[model samples]
Target: MSIDITLTVNGREINTEVSPETTLVQLLREHLLLTGTHVGCDTSQCGACTVHLDGRAVKSCTVLAVQADGSEVTTIEGIAVAGGLHPMQAAFHQCHGLQCGFCTAGMIMSAIDLVTREDDLDEATIRKGLAGNICRCTGYHNIVKAVQMAAGQMEGRGHE
Candidate 1:
């Protein structure tokens, strides 16, 4: 059976039909064609498929498409502004937070959430918050630095 669902992705309304077993990642990637939200591990052990659902980070692979009905979803594609990248994304580029870039999307999504939830972000705190997202190529040192950089900028700019 197929179910009709609506989603707000990248600030645009999307309407589609999906099977009950279809995951959120499948809906975004296959149906909507937002491939930036990578699928590294289908088991959700790796946070590569992370996306923001209702302004919080979630594993898209673990969430069913039907479950996201009427929700606002933000993939990496949605993170940029009209002419510039989000502060968090810029920080990642400046800090070299990614190597292979496979996990960069998920890491940025998770980092944005971390900055939103925490008032005081430190190395240890960033590391703890990012424990769920794994980077196989680059050590987390650069990732932590990127999060810290973005955290400082996010204080005045606010979280996305």
Candidate 2:
């Protein structure tokens, strides 16, 4: 069966019909065409499908479309401002946090959530905060650095 849902995505209000079994990730990528939220692992083991649901990070694959009804969703494409990169995205680019770029979108989404919700983040804390997201490329040194850098830039932004 199909159900109608209304949600705000990337600052736009979207109303559509989705199957009861449709995941948020599928609603995003296949229906809405927001492919930035990748689908690395369908089982939610990998955080590549992460996005912000009501201002918090969530694995989109784990969230059904009905659960996101009447909610606000932020994908990687939504985080950018005025055609420029978000602070976290800029930090990732500056710190060389990604290779192959498969997991970059989810990493940035999680990092933004971590920095916004926590304070005085140390390397260990950053590592712990990002434990849910996995990067198979580098040793995560650069990812940690990128989170730290973005944390500074986003210090007073208060969940942007």
TM-score of each: 0.95, 0.95
Q: Candidate 1 has what TM-score?
A: 0.95
Q: Please give the TM-score that candidate 2 achieves against the real structure.
A: 0.95
Measured with C-alpha atoms, the lDDT of residue 43 in candidate 2 is 91
Cα lDDT of model 1 by residue, 1-160, tens digit: 9999998998999998999999999999998889999999899888999999999999999999999999999999998868999999999999998899999999999999999888877789889999889998856899999999988887543433
Clashes of 2: 0
Model 2, stretches more than 4 Å misplaced? Answer: 155-160
* Model 1 alpha-carbon miss at residue 140, Å: 0.6
Cα lDDT for residue 26, candidate 1: 95
lDDT of 2 by residue, 65-141 (tens): 99999999999999887978999999999999988889899999999999988876999999999998888785489
